[model samples]
Target: MERSTGVQAYYAESAERLGEVYESVSFEDVHGALLDLLPEAPARVLDVGAGTGRDATALAGRGYTVDAVEPVAELRRVAERLHPGSGVTWRPGALPEIPGVRGPYDVVLLSAVWMHLPPEERPGAMRRLAGLLAPGGLLLITLRRGEPPVDRRMFDIPPEEVADQGAAAGLRLLRTVAEGADRLGRDAVRWHAVVLQLG
Candidate 1:
Protein backbone atom coordinates (compact mmCIF):
# COMPACT_ATOMS: atom_id res chain seq x y z
CA MET A 1 0.00 0.00 0.00
CA GLU A 2 1.32 3.43 -0.94
CA ARG A 3 1.56 5.70 2.05
CA SER A 4 0.02 9.17 2.13
CA THR A 5 2.21 12.27 2.03
CA GLY A 6 1.65 12.82 5.74
CA VAL A 7 2.57 9.23 6.54
CA GLN A 8 5.74 9.52 4.49
CA ALA A 9 6.88 12.54 6.43
CA TYR A 10 5.98 10.98 9.75
CA TYR A 11 7.99 7.87 8.90
CA ALA A 12 10.92 9.89 7.61
CA GLU A 13 11.15 11.77 10.90
CA SER A 14 10.70 8.60 12.95
CA ALA A 15 13.37 6.77 10.99
CA GLU A 16 15.81 9.57 11.61
CA ARG A 17 15.07 9.74 15.32
CA LEU A 18 14.97 5.98 15.77
CA GLY A 19 18.28 5.51 14.01
CA GLU A 20 19.96 7.30 16.88
CA VAL A 21 18.28 5.44 19.75
CA TYR A 22 17.21 2.16 18.13
CA GLU A 23 19.30 0.05 20.45
CA SER A 24 18.46 1.82 23.68
CA VAL A 25 14.63 1.86 23.82
CA SER A 26 13.44 -0.70 26.26
CA PHE A 27 11.48 -3.65 24.78
CA GLU A 28 10.24 -4.82 28.17
CA ASP A 29 6.79 -3.32 27.78
CA VAL A 30 6.37 -4.48 24.22
CA HIS A 31 7.64 -7.96 24.96
CA GLY A 32 5.53 -8.29 28.05
CA ALA A 33 2.46 -7.21 26.11
CA LEU A 34 3.02 -9.81 23.43
CA LEU A 35 3.81 -12.51 25.97
CA ASP A 36 0.67 -11.73 27.89
CA LEU A 37 -1.36 -12.58 24.81
CA LEU A 38 0.67 -15.62 23.83
CA PRO A 39 2.12 -17.09 26.99
CA GLU A 40 2.62 -20.72 26.10
CA ALA A 41 4.76 -20.99 23.00
CA PRO A 42 5.94 -19.35 19.84
CA ALA A 43 3.11 -18.00 17.72
CA ARG A 44 2.86 -16.33 14.36
CA VAL A 45 3.30 -12.63 15.07
CA LEU A 46 2.92 -9.66 12.77
CA ASP A 47 4.76 -6.50 13.77
CA VAL A 48 3.11 -3.76 11.77
CA GLY A 49 5.15 -0.67 10.94
CA ALA A 50 8.05 -2.39 12.56
CA GLY A 51 10.48 0.51 12.62
CA THR A 52 14.03 -0.62 13.47
CA GLY A 53 12.72 -4.13 14.26
CA ARG A 54 13.25 -3.86 18.00
CA ASP A 55 10.12 -5.74 18.97
CA ALA A 56 10.29 -8.11 16.01
CA THR A 57 13.85 -9.17 16.74
CA ALA A 58 13.12 -9.64 20.42
CA LEU A 59 10.15 -11.87 19.64
CA ALA A 60 12.17 -13.90 17.15
CA GLY A 61 14.90 -14.36 19.74
CA ARG A 62 12.32 -15.81 22.06
CA GLY A 63 11.47 -18.41 19.36
CA TYR A 64 8.39 -16.73 17.88
CA THR A 65 8.00 -16.60 14.11
CA VAL A 66 7.77 -12.92 13.38
CA ASP A 67 6.75 -11.21 10.15
CA ALA A 68 8.14 -7.71 10.42
CA VAL A 69 6.76 -5.07 8.07
CA GLU A 70 8.38 -1.68 7.56
CA PRO A 71 7.64 0.83 4.82
CA VAL A 72 10.78 2.92 5.13
CA ALA A 73 13.81 1.55 3.29
CA GLU A 74 16.31 2.82 5.82
CA LEU A 75 14.43 1.29 8.73
CA ARG A 76 14.16 -2.03 6.91
CA ARG A 77 17.92 -2.02 6.34
CA VAL A 78 18.53 -1.30 9.98
CA ALA A 79 16.17 -4.09 11.03
CA GLU A 80 17.93 -6.52 8.69
CA ARG A 81 21.30 -5.67 10.16
CA LEU A 82 20.19 -5.91 13.76
CA HIS A 83 18.36 -9.18 13.29
CA PRO A 84 20.71 -11.04 11.02
CA GLY A 85 19.86 -14.74 10.79
CA SER A 86 17.14 -14.16 13.34
CA GLY A 87 14.58 -15.92 11.07
CA VAL A 88 12.46 -12.82 10.90
CA THR A 89 10.82 -12.40 7.51
CA TRP A 90 11.27 -8.73 6.69
CA ARG A 91 8.69 -7.23 4.33
CA PRO A 92 8.61 -3.75 2.82
CA GLY A 93 5.11 -2.39 3.24
CA ALA A 94 2.78 -0.42 5.50
CA LEU A 95 -0.28 -1.19 7.52
CA PRO A 96 -3.45 -2.86 5.94
CA GLU A 97 -1.34 -4.45 3.20
CA ILE A 98 1.63 -6.41 4.47
CA PRO A 99 3.60 -7.90 1.60
CA GLY A 100 4.85 -11.51 1.60
CA VAL A 101 3.34 -12.25 5.00
CA ARG A 102 0.10 -14.19 4.93
CA GLY A 103 -1.98 -14.21 8.06
CA PRO A 104 -4.36 -15.49 10.29
CA TYR A 105 -1.54 -14.63 12.64
CA ASP A 106 -1.83 -15.35 16.34
CA VAL A 107 -1.09 -11.72 17.17
CA VAL A 108 -0.96 -8.45 15.24
CA LEU A 109 0.94 -5.57 16.82
CA LEU A 110 0.35 -1.92 15.95
CA SER A 111 2.60 -0.14 18.36
CA ALA A 112 2.94 3.61 18.10
CA VAL A 113 1.70 3.62 14.54
CA TRP A 114 -1.95 4.58 15.04
CA MET A 115 -1.44 8.32 15.33
CA HIS A 116 0.38 8.44 12.05
CA LEU A 117 -2.76 7.42 10.16
CA PRO A 118 -5.09 10.14 8.97
CA PRO A 119 -8.48 10.19 10.64
CA GLU A 120 -10.40 9.39 7.47
CA GLU A 121 -8.36 6.29 6.81
CA ARG A 122 -8.32 4.91 10.32
CA PRO A 123 -11.56 2.90 10.16
CA GLY A 124 -10.63 1.10 6.98
CA ALA A 125 -7.12 0.52 8.29
CA MET A 126 -8.49 -0.94 11.50
CA ARG A 127 -10.79 -3.29 9.63
CA ARG A 128 -8.00 -4.41 7.35
CA LEU A 129 -5.75 -4.99 10.35
CA ALA A 130 -8.39 -7.10 12.07
CA GLY A 131 -8.89 -9.14 8.91
CA LEU A 132 -5.34 -10.44 9.26
CA LEU A 133 -6.00 -12.10 12.58
CA ALA A 134 -6.83 -15.73 13.01
CA PRO A 135 -9.93 -16.80 14.89
CA GLY A 136 -9.44 -15.96 18.56
CA GLY A 137 -6.26 -14.12 17.55
CA LEU A 138 -5.30 -11.02 19.50
CA LEU A 139 -4.89 -7.55 18.09
CA LEU A 140 -2.70 -5.38 20.28
CA ILE A 141 -2.59 -1.65 19.62
CA THR A 142 -0.70 1.07 21.46
CA LEU A 143 -2.15 4.53 20.97
CA ARG A 144 -0.35 7.68 21.99
CA ARG A 145 -2.86 10.25 23.12
CA GLY A 146 -1.86 13.83 23.77
CA GLU A 147 -1.34 17.22 22.23
CA PRO A 148 -0.73 17.10 18.52
CA PRO A 149 2.52 18.36 17.09
CA VAL A 150 2.53 21.93 15.94
CA ASP A 151 2.46 20.72 12.35
CA ARG A 152 -1.20 19.63 12.68
CA ARG A 153 -0.79 17.02 9.95
CA MET A 154 -1.54 14.04 12.16
CA PHE A 155 -4.55 13.21 14.29
CA ASP A 156 -4.04 12.65 18.02
CA ILE A 157 -7.10 10.59 18.84
CA PRO A 158 -8.37 9.97 22.32
CA PRO A 159 -8.62 6.48 23.87
CA GLU A 160 -12.40 6.40 23.45
CA GLU A 161 -11.99 7.03 19.75
CA VAL A 162 -9.54 4.20 19.53
CA ALA A 163 -11.97 1.83 21.21
CA ASP A 164 -14.76 2.89 18.89
CA GLN A 165 -12.61 2.26 15.84
CA GLY A 166 -11.78 -1.21 17.09
CA ALA A 167 -15.46 -2.01 17.51
CA ALA A 168 -16.26 -0.75 14.05
CA ALA A 169 -13.58 -3.05 12.72
CA GLY A 170 -15.26 -6.10 14.21
CA LEU A 171 -12.82 -6.42 17.08
CA ARG A 172 -14.03 -6.91 20.62
CA LEU A 173 -12.11 -4.96 23.22
CA LEU A 174 -10.61 -7.21 25.86
CA ARG A 175 -8.76 -4.70 28.01
CA THR A 176 -7.07 -1.30 28.06
CA VAL A 177 -4.09 0.06 29.98
CA ALA A 178 -3.51 3.79 30.04
CA GLU A 179 -0.66 5.83 31.57
CA GLY A 180 1.31 9.11 31.49
CA ALA A 181 0.65 12.48 33.15
CA ASP A 182 0.54 16.18 32.37
CA ARG A 183 1.77 19.09 34.52
CA LEU A 184 -1.39 19.18 36.66
CA GLY A 185 -1.57 15.39 37.03
CA ARG A 186 -4.00 15.24 34.14
CA ASP A 187 -3.21 12.46 31.71
CA ALA A 188 -1.07 13.78 28.92
CA VAL A 189 0.66 11.63 26.42
CA ARG A 190 -1.49 8.70 27.45
CA TRP A 191 -0.20 5.40 26.19
CA HIS A 192 -3.28 3.24 25.77
CA ALA A 193 -2.39 -0.35 25.22
CA VAL A 194 -5.56 -2.13 24.21
CA VAL A 195 -6.17 -5.80 23.58
CA LEU A 196 -8.85 -6.91 21.16
CA GLN A 197 -10.13 -10.29 20.16
CA LEU A 198 -10.71 -10.80 16.48
CA GLY A 199 -14.17 -11.80 15.38
Candidate 2:
Protein backbone atom coordinates (compact mmCIF):
# COMPACT_ATOMS: atom_id res chain seq x y z
CA MET A 1 0.00 0.00 0.00
CA GLU A 2 3.04 2.24 -0.10
CA ARG A 3 2.11 3.48 -3.55
CA SER A 4 -1.40 4.18 -2.41
CA THR A 5 -0.38 7.33 -0.53
CA GLY A 6 -1.11 9.56 -3.49
CA VAL A 7 -4.52 8.04 -4.12
CA GLN A 8 -5.42 8.18 -0.42
CA ALA A 9 -4.34 11.78 -0.21
CA TYR A 10 -6.23 12.74 -3.35
CA TYR A 11 -9.50 11.35 -2.03
CA ALA A 12 -8.93 12.66 1.49
CA GLU A 13 -8.47 16.20 0.27
CA SER A 14 -11.04 16.20 -2.50
CA ALA A 15 -13.84 14.24 -0.80
CA GLU A 16 -15.96 17.34 -0.31
CA ARG A 17 -15.46 18.45 -3.87
CA LEU A 18 -16.17 14.99 -5.21
CA GLY A 19 -19.20 14.62 -2.99
CA GLU A 20 -20.68 17.81 -4.36
CA VAL A 21 -20.17 16.60 -7.89
CA TYR A 22 -21.62 13.20 -7.07
CA GLU A 23 -24.57 14.72 -5.24
CA SER A 24 -25.65 16.50 -8.39
CA VAL A 25 -25.80 13.22 -10.29
CA SER A 26 -28.17 10.32 -10.06
CA PHE A 27 -27.12 6.70 -9.52
CA GLU A 28 -28.75 5.91 -12.83
CA ASP A 29 -26.48 8.40 -14.52
CA VAL A 30 -23.51 6.52 -13.13
CA HIS A 31 -24.76 2.94 -13.40
CA GLY A 32 -27.59 3.06 -15.92
CA ALA A 33 -25.54 0.79 -18.15
CA LEU A 34 -26.49 -2.18 -15.98
CA LEU A 35 -30.05 -1.20 -15.18
CA ASP A 36 -31.42 -4.38 -16.67
CA LEU A 37 -28.79 -6.61 -15.15
CA LEU A 38 -29.06 -5.50 -11.52
CA PRO A 39 -30.92 -7.78 -9.21
CA GLU A 40 -34.32 -6.83 -7.82
CA ALA A 41 -34.72 -4.41 -4.93
CA PRO A 42 -33.97 -5.71 -1.42
CA ALA A 43 -31.18 -7.84 -2.79
CA ARG A 44 -27.79 -7.73 -1.06
CA VAL A 45 -25.28 -5.38 -2.69
CA LEU A 46 -21.61 -4.88 -1.93
CA ASP A 47 -20.37 -1.50 -3.13
CA VAL A 48 -16.61 -1.82 -2.98
CA GLY A 49 -14.65 1.40 -2.96
CA ALA A 50 -17.93 3.16 -2.37
CA GLY A 51 -17.04 6.83 -2.02
CA THR A 52 -19.31 9.30 -0.24
CA GLY A 53 -21.96 6.57 -0.03
CA ARG A 54 -23.82 8.13 -2.96
CA ASP A 55 -24.48 4.94 -4.90
CA ALA A 56 -24.90 2.76 -1.84
CA THR A 57 -27.30 5.18 -0.19
CA ALA A 58 -29.28 5.50 -3.39
CA LEU A 59 -29.56 1.74 -3.72
CA ALA A 60 -30.50 1.47 -0.06
CA GLY A 61 -33.18 4.09 -0.57
CA ARG A 62 -34.55 1.86 -3.30
CA GLY A 63 -34.70 -1.07 -0.82
CA TYR A 64 -31.42 -2.80 -1.41
CA THR A 65 -29.18 -3.96 1.45
CA VAL A 66 -25.89 -2.25 0.79
CA ASP A 67 -22.45 -2.55 2.38
CA ALA A 68 -20.32 0.39 1.32
CA VAL A 69 -16.56 -0.09 1.64
CA GLU A 70 -14.21 2.85 1.63
CA PRO A 71 -10.71 2.73 3.12
CA VAL A 72 -10.23 6.48 3.23
CA ALA A 73 -11.40 7.81 6.57
CA GLU A 74 -11.76 11.30 5.20
CA LEU A 75 -14.30 10.24 2.59
CA ARG A 76 -16.04 7.78 4.92
CA ARG A 77 -16.60 10.49 7.53
CA VAL A 78 -18.06 12.86 4.99
CA ALA A 79 -20.19 10.09 3.51
CA GLU A 80 -21.56 9.08 6.89
CA ARG A 81 -22.51 12.64 7.63
CA LEU A 82 -23.96 13.22 4.20
CA HIS A 83 -26.21 10.18 4.27
CA PRO A 84 -26.87 9.80 7.96
CA GLY A 85 -29.04 6.88 9.02
CA SER A 86 -29.59 5.97 5.39
CA GLY A 87 -29.34 2.26 6.28
CA VAL A 88 -25.99 1.91 4.55
CA THR A 89 -23.24 0.14 6.49
CA TRP A 90 -19.94 1.84 5.75
CA ARG A 91 -16.72 -0.13 6.27
CA PRO A 92 -13.07 0.78 6.11
CA GLY A 93 -11.48 -1.38 3.45
CA ALA A 94 -9.65 -1.42 0.13
CA LEU A 95 -9.20 -3.56 -2.93
CA PRO A 96 -7.17 -6.81 -3.30
CA GLU A 97 -7.99 -7.27 0.37
CA ILE A 98 -11.26 -5.78 1.71
CA PRO A 99 -11.51 -6.86 5.33
CA GLY A 100 -14.38 -7.29 7.77
CA VAL A 101 -17.08 -7.38 5.12
CA ARG A 102 -19.12 -10.48 4.46
CA GLY A 103 -20.31 -11.21 0.96
CA PRO A 104 -22.34 -13.64 -1.16
CA TYR A 105 -23.94 -10.52 -2.53
CA ASP A 106 -26.48 -10.44 -5.32
CA VAL A 107 -24.76 -7.46 -6.87
CA VAL A 108 -21.13 -6.40 -6.41
CA LEU A 109 -20.42 -2.93 -7.71
CA LEU A 110 -16.98 -1.43 -8.31
CA SER A 111 -17.78 1.88 -9.89
CA ALA A 112 -14.99 4.05 -11.29
CA VAL A 113 -12.63 2.52 -8.74
CA TRP A 114 -11.04 -0.33 -10.67
CA MET A 115 -8.38 1.78 -12.31
CA HIS A 116 -6.86 2.57 -8.97
CA LEU A 117 -5.46 -0.91 -8.53
CA PRO A 118 -2.03 -1.48 -9.91
CA PRO A 119 -2.04 -3.65 -13.03
CA GLU A 120 -0.66 -6.70 -11.22
CA GLU A 121 -3.46 -6.78 -8.66
CA ARG A 122 -6.35 -6.93 -11.14
CA PRO A 123 -6.45 -10.71 -11.31
CA GLY A 124 -6.42 -11.30 -7.57
CA ALA A 125 -8.84 -8.48 -7.01
CA MET A 126 -11.19 -9.89 -9.61
CA ARG A 127 -10.90 -13.33 -8.07
CA ARG A 128 -11.62 -12.00 -4.60
CA LEU A 129 -14.63 -10.05 -5.84
CA ALA A 130 -15.86 -13.05 -7.76
CA GLY A 131 -15.65 -15.11 -4.60
CA LEU A 132 -18.09 -12.73 -2.94
CA LEU A 133 -20.88 -13.13 -5.51
CA ALA A 134 -23.82 -15.38 -4.80
CA PRO A 135 -24.84 -17.95 -7.35
CA GLY A 136 -25.90 -16.16 -10.54
CA GLY A 137 -24.75 -12.92 -8.97
CA LEU A 138 -23.64 -10.01 -11.10
CA LEU A 139 -20.26 -8.30 -10.76
CA LEU A 140 -20.61 -4.82 -12.16
CA ILE A 141 -17.40 -2.93 -12.84
CA THR A 142 -16.81 0.42 -14.50
CA LEU A 143 -13.34 0.94 -15.91
CA ARG A 144 -12.00 4.40 -16.57
CA ARG A 145 -9.99 4.55 -19.76
CA GLY A 146 -7.71 7.52 -20.46
CA GLU A 147 -4.86 9.48 -19.08
CA PRO A 148 -5.00 10.27 -15.37
CA PRO A 149 -5.00 13.72 -13.95
CA VAL A 150 -1.54 15.23 -13.74
CA ASP A 151 -1.85 15.10 -9.97
CA ARG A 152 -4.03 12.02 -9.54
CA ARG A 153 -2.99 8.45 -10.25
CA MET A 154 -4.93 6.27 -12.68
CA PHE A 155 -4.31 3.87 -15.49
CA ASP A 156 -6.11 3.56 -18.80
CA ILE A 157 -7.62 0.19 -17.93
CA PRO A 158 -8.46 -1.82 -21.02
CA PRO A 159 -12.00 -3.20 -21.17
CA GLU A 160 -10.99 -6.31 -23.06
CA GLU A 161 -8.42 -7.12 -20.43
CA VAL A 162 -11.00 -6.81 -17.68
CA ALA A 163 -13.23 -9.20 -19.59
CA ASP A 164 -10.39 -11.65 -19.78
CA GLN A 165 -9.83 -11.33 -16.04
CA GLY A 166 -13.46 -12.09 -15.39
CA ALA A 167 -13.27 -15.19 -17.51
CA ALA A 168 -10.17 -16.26 -15.72
CA ALA A 169 -11.98 -15.82 -12.44
CA GLY A 170 -14.63 -18.30 -13.66
CA LEU A 171 -17.24 -15.63 -14.25
CA ARG A 172 -19.25 -15.27 -17.46
CA LEU A 173 -19.72 -11.96 -19.16
CA LEU A 174 -23.37 -10.98 -19.47
CA ARG A 175 -23.40 -7.55 -21.11
CA THR A 176 -20.98 -4.82 -22.06
CA VAL A 177 -22.16 -1.25 -22.42
CA ALA A 178 -20.70 1.12 -24.94
CA GLU A 179 -18.00 3.53 -23.85
CA GLY A 180 -19.02 6.99 -22.70
CA ALA A 181 -17.47 10.17 -21.42
CA ASP A 182 -17.13 10.75 -17.71
CA ARG A 183 -20.35 11.70 -15.97
CA LEU A 184 -18.67 14.90 -14.86
CA GLY A 185 -17.82 15.68 -18.49
CA ARG A 186 -14.09 15.25 -18.05
CA ASP A 187 -12.96 15.20 -21.69
CA ALA A 188 -9.84 13.14 -21.12
CA VAL A 189 -11.89 10.41 -19.49
CA ARG A 190 -13.97 7.55 -20.89
CA TRP A 191 -15.67 4.68 -19.09
CA HIS A 192 -16.88 1.20 -20.01
CA ALA A 193 -19.08 -1.09 -17.97
CA VAL A 194 -19.06 -4.89 -17.95
CA VAL A 195 -21.55 -7.13 -16.19
CA LEU A 196 -20.27 -10.61 -15.37
CA GLN A 197 -22.22 -13.39 -13.74
CA LEU A 198 -21.07 -16.10 -11.40
CA GLY A 199 -22.78 -19.28 -12.49
Top candidate (lDDT): 2
The numbered model that scores best in TM-score is 2
The lDDT for every candidate, in the order shown, is 0.74, 0.87
| Alpha carbon lDDT at 116, candidate 1 | 78
lDDT of 1 by residue, 27-144 (tens): 6744454456663457888888888888888878778889988888878887787768988898888755555667888888877787777777788888888888988888887776
- Among residues 3 or more apart in sequence or in different chains, the pairs in candidate 1 whose N, CA or C atoms overlap within 3 Å are none
lDDT of 2 by residue, 1-199 (tens): 1138889898889999988988888898888767877778879999988888889999999899999999888889989999999999988889887867778999999988888888888899899999999999999988887777778778777778888999999999898886687888889888899889999
The TM-score, computed over Cα atoms with residue i paired to residue i, of candidate 1 is 0.85
C-alpha lDDT of residue 27 in model 2: 92
User: Any runs in candidate 2 off by more than 4 Å, and if so which?
Assistant: 1-3
- Residue 92 displacement (Å), model 2: 0.2
Clash count per candidate: 0, 0
Candidate 2: C-alpha lDDT: 0.87
